[model samples]
Target: MPVYVRGPKDIPDTVAQASAAASRVLQSIIKGKIIKSIKDMSLEKIETKAKE
Candidate 1:
């Protein structure tokens, strides 16, 4: 899955926050966990799982 980084609403703070978020995502990848895509999950399944 591709990772996406979105900036903050305030233009001045966007770059730093986006960089930090991207760095954190990269660190998670380095730890070997797969990033699951929400688009692949069905709404009913998600709701059921969340209720568990």
Candidate 2:
């Protein structure tokens, strides 16, 4: 069962967001070090890094 929470669904700065995401994914692919874990799906690390 899934519960849906409603809030702001629009992304701010969509182009920048897509570019950043694409870069991350490409880096993972290029390194051939991709693995599955909670960290792989986390945004907090990215957010913190962005804030620095």
Candidate 3:
């Protein structure tokens, strides 16, 4: 099933917190890949690189 999200003013505090957290996790996954793609194209290596 698909998920639906409502704003802070439209939902209770607990649901709003959960929705916000889910959004953050999705955003982080998308951003992490984009960052790795732009940096030396070294996404295939075993060792991890530090981000500054």
Candidate 4:
């Protein structure tokens, strides 16, 4: 999975930091594919497998 982080200088407000963290968590929950038994996998992995 791709990881995104706010640079120390980029985020200055406490509210913004909290909002970004929540957004990242929600995105992680909704953006992945549901596998049958193993954990949910990201769509990126499925696309890569299809190419192979």
**Candidate of highest lDDT:** 1
Residue-wise lDDT of candidate 2 within 1-52, one digit each (tens)? Answer: 9677965446766777898999998987798545555466568865664464
Q: Rate residue 12 of model 1 by lDDT.
A: 55
Worst 10 residues of 4 by lDDT: 32-41
Query: Would you list the clashing residue pairs of candidate 1?
Result: none
Assess the local accuracy of residue 6 in candidate 4 as a C-alpha lDDT between 0 and 100.
57
Clashes per model (N, Cα, C within 3 A): 0, 0, 0, 0
Clashing pairs in 4: none
1-52, model 1: which lDDT tens digit per residue?
Answer: 9676964388657888999999987977797443477688889977875574
Candidate 1 segments whose C-alpha is farther than 4 A from its true place: 1-10, 35-52
Model 1 RMSD, rounded to 1 decimal = 10.8
Cα-based lDDT at residue 11, candidate 2: 71
Please give the CA lDDT of all the candidate structures: 0.73, 0.70, 0.63, 0.66
User: Which of candidates 1 and 3 is the stronger one according to lDDT?
Assistant: 1
**Residue 15: error of model 2 in Å?**
0.6
Q: Output the lDDT of residue 47, model 3.
A: 44
Task: Kindly indicate the candidate among 1 and 4 with the higher lDDT.
Answer: 1
**By lDDT, is 1 or 2 better?**
1
Question: Which residue pairs come into collision in candidate 3?
Answer: none
Give TM per candidate.
0.43, 0.41, 0.40, 0.38
Best by TM-score: 1
lDDT of 3 by residue, 1-52 (tens): 9676954454587788898999987887787732535455565442453442
lDDT of 4 by residue, 17-40 (tens): 899999886776686533444346
